[model samples]
Every structure is written in structure tokens, then in C-alpha cells.
Target: MLLSALLGVCLIPAHSKPAGEQLGSPLLQTCFEEAKKIVDDAYKYSREESLRRVRKEVVRPHDALRLLKQPRGGTRSAVRSADYMAQTLRLLQERVHHVHKRSLNVTDLLSEEDLNKLSEITGCASQVTFPSCRTTPNLNTYRTANSVCNNIKNPRLGSSNTPFARWLPAEYDDAISQPKGWDRTRRFNNFLLPTGYDVRQVSNNILSTTDAGVVNDREYTHMVTMFGQWNDHDLTFTPFSPSIRSFSNGINCDESCEKIEPCIPIPIPPGDPRLPTGRNSCIPAFRSAPVCGSGYSAFNFGGEPKKREQINALTAFLD
Candidate 1:
């Protein structure tokens, strides 16, 4: 189950599938087996279990999304997640043992074999799948005049998914796992900005601001996030809320294509409480078909033109 979730290589069990389509990627299989061997050796040889987890952004998702092809199953079980965590810890502990065995500490160099294997595995992203975001949002510097902003509050009352991020967790003291109070907001320019990113400073008499790259950043960026696991982490999915408009004073929904070209009287409601002075029975509801939005580069790369709801979905994801 763990292997299946992480990489959908084995659609059916080994026995069920024929010889030609027997196993998953050889690299993947070797990785799991090697990881398991290291763990087993650690337990047998009384090795150090100084294992730690570092938060990291990975490129493996590109391949996982490509290989999975379709949704096999949605993740919903805590038991499954916990089990995977245990397995990962074991792998980490094995690495600790390996370090001790080779007398390799912080300054030590890994054998050439390890580096080559890592490079090969990580470079597995194929152009065939997950090409890129077509409608990539433009990133630009914030300007007070343009009313460009980030860190705006969501008007509808609801708690942010992560309280530690918003200072809601007063008792949060895990400095090692969580960001230091001062460092939380201070993104290291070298780290957050991509490689080869040039920096420029913009300022006024009072204070200076950074405008390293682009002109007008998108109001929000929406990427389709998916989770499967041999390894994964917690992610909060924030959906967007769309604005609802109320039209009045010569806005004819009943007569336009919004409702129908040749509009007719539709039942508003029997004796509506908000009826104006001297109104007859029911009036036109002015119901309209949802005319989807236009094609934009924001559509997922290498796919059909994006419709209105897809745009909304991206907005919702960002929201």
C-alpha cells in the first residue's frame, strides 16, 4: 500500500500481473530495498538512530504525477500516514548508521556511487508529462498606488489552516521543527529567490523596499497540488470564494441571453414578501446559463483551453 501510494508503478499485485509488466521502476525498487537493508543493518549492528526530518521542496512530484496517470485512490487515512512516517524514520536512521560506519560527519564526502545515484533519480523528470503551467501568473513588485498586496485578510470569518503561521499558537515552542520567531517572516533572499535571480532595491525618504525581479506579480498564484506518498507532508488546501453580484436599475437579465434571448415570465415565488407596490402574480426569475470564462495561459500546460470553472478552481485553491 505504501509503495502503491508513493508511485503507482504496480497497478496490481506481482502475481496478478504478467512477466512483461511485473514490477515498478528498477531505480525505485532498488531504492526501497537499499533503504530497507540499511535500516535492518542499523538494528542488527547497534547503530545510532539520530534521525531528523528537514522540510524540503522536491521535484519528484513531476514524475509521480506523470506515472500515476489517473487517480488510483484518494488519501484519507491517518493510520496509513502514520505507518509511512514510521518507515521514513527507519530510512533516516539507516543513513545515520552509514555516516558512522564511514567516519563521515558534516565535512565528510560521500562515495562517488551515492552522488551519481542521487543525480540519476532526481533528473528523472520527463518532458512528456507535466510540461508546465501555461497560464503562469506574472510576479511583480508591490506598489501602494496600484493597491498591490499580499498578507491581506480573508473577509469571511474563518481560521487560517495553520495557526502557528498566524501567531495563534502561543504555546508553540518547537524551535527546531518550527521557524524561529524572528526568522519566520524573514525569507532569506538567496534561498527564496531562484538561482540567477538579480536583486534591486526601491526606496523612498522614509524606508527602502526590495524589488528584485518582475513588475506586477499576480494577485494570487494557483497551482494544482496533489499528494501521494512513499513520502509526503501536511498541506492545507485553501479554496477561493467568488464574488456574487446583485444587478438592479435597468439591468435586464430576463430579456438578455443571460437568462434567455426571448425572455418569458418565470415564477419568482407565490406572493413574494419583497413585492413592490401593485405587482401582479409571479415575475421573471431571469435565470441564466453559466457562460464559462475564456481561454487563458493560466490553463494547465499541454491541455485543452481552460473554462470558467477551472479558473475558479485555481482561484479557490489559492484562496
Candidate 2:
């Protein structure tokens, strides 16, 4: 009886089909083709717009330092690669949303194999694959600036411009790609989460320091604070989205207060002490750059796109 039961489990009809064979179904094939076209058009527009911004530049002394601090060489390439993957994944999600009748997480509907096929279609499979790490004599003596090849067995481990490892699984609002607190109406644990602006107001009211409230600490100097910030930067630096405009609607993030992809503007609450409170008056913010092959689904196939994760521009380890 036991042997038969084990055999029954192995012979299950659902499990019999070859992996990713479902993508060949007419519905999925149509969705994939439509999604591909959308991705191609949007990606081209974004790339052209970004280039236009870069070419028309006015670099002052203050801007010089900021520009110098921007990602360079491999790091810059990693960011661009991530942007492509993110754009592809988000558009795919939108396609899936429209095709499915009932509300469901895209991850639930799509398998690892399905996502892999989609990535291949979008040319994202090449971007997510790990590069061959070339060993060097200097690697043994000193850490590479980007932290590549730091580990003999795992070359990309703790590397700069790589995704930060998650201690726990990510918890997106949509359980797939949407960021936390993305849906204003969505409730978690029977409680609505506060808006980013509301949280900022609370911080100002409770944590702001006045001249009388300031207290000097003789044990530590300003160097301590500077060093702390420097050390923090060494460990992690999450770059924001390179595009200043939305890919979906082409709305300038700096001008729009609407919470959209790339733009999560912090609205100033009414009766704020410092900043003005109005519909258009809000602090502009951009979403962090996601790792290629992350923030798409729950399943990961050989470094394929999974849940969204922010890229760390520096080594996570002490260098």
C-alpha cells in the first residue's frame, strides 16, 4: 500500500507535463507576445530620454562632486542591467493582470519555467546570468574596487553593485512585485499603514531638536558621525532609479505627487512646521534600483528574476 501511494504521487497528472510547457498554451503565448512589444517600446523611449538628459548637462563645482560619486565602470553597467530587467518584469506583470479574470498574484499563476521563458524573450536571461570571474594575483593581496572575485567559490558574493541578501523573504503588498505600503487602501493585520509623509511629520514633531534640547556628548567628536556615515556607505549604497520620468506615462517624477513607479513622492501633511502643505508640494523620491532577476516572482531558476531586491553599490562585508 505504501509503495503504491508513493508511486501515485510521482505519477500525478499535473506533475507529468514538462516544465514551462504551459507557456506554449495559446493564452500564455499571446500574453507573452503582447508583453514583449510593450517592453520593447517602453525601454527604447526610456533609454532615449535618459541619454537626452545626460547630453544636455551643466556641471557646476557642487554638481561635479555629485557626478563623480555616480556609479562607474562595472557598477554603472550593473545598474543599467537592473533597470532593463525591472522594466521587463513590471510590464509583464501588467500583462498578466489584464489577461487573468480574477485577482491573483502573478507568481501564483506563473511558474519558474514560465518566467525563465519570458526573461529569454525580453533578453533579460543574459543580463541575470553570473559573469565568469577572472582570478588575479592582486585579488589575493587587495580587494577589487567592485568586490568581484572576493570569494574563490562564489565570485559575485558580497560584490558591489549586487543585490543585498535577504535575511527573510520579501513581503511585497502584492506578494510579487509591488513595494510595501504601495496600495493606500490595502490593509494589513486590520490596520492601514501610514503614508510616508505622515511618518515624516511624526518624526519632526517627536524627534526634532531645538537649541535648548541639544545636548553635547564629550565622549565622541564630529569625526565619529562622519566615520559612521563613511562606514555605512562602504557597506551599502542603494542607487535610485536613473530615470527622472515614469516609464508608463512619461510623467516627470519631480513634478508629480502621484505615487507611481519610480516616483513615491512624500506629501507634506497639513500644518507642517517647515515645508509647505499642498497637492503639488511634496518631496520627490525615486524607488531604489532593483537587482536584475529579482522582485518579479517567488521562484528563482539559476539566478533568474525572483522577488525585487535593491542593489548594494558596495561590498556588504568589511573590506
TM-score of each: 0.19, 0.70
| Candidate 2 TM-score, C-alpha based | 0.70
Go through the candidates in order and give each one's C-alpha lDDT: 0.25, 0.61
Residue 291, candidate 2: C-alpha displacement in angstroms: 1.5
The digit string of per-residue lDDT tens for model 2 on 1-319 reads 0121122111123333343333222333444444444444544564575455555665334233333455666666666555554554454456454455445445545655666665565445554566666646577788776667778788878877777787998888877567778898888998988876776688788998889998889798899999999889779887765555676676877678877877777778887887778878877667876666666532434443356777788788766
Provide the RMSD of all predictions against the true structure, rounded to 1 decimal: 27.4, 9.7
Best by lDDT: 2
How many clashes in each candidate?
7, 6
Model 1 C-alpha lDDT per residue in residues 1-319, reported as the tens digit of each score:
1233343221223343232321223323344444334334433222121111112344334223322321111111111121122232233234433434443221122233432332233221121122233232441444222112222332211222111123232221122112122233434534442211011111122244356643554663333233232112222322211101112112232233222211223333333334322323323331111111112111112233333111110111222
Instruction: Tell me the deviation in Å of residue 249 in model 1.
Output: 71
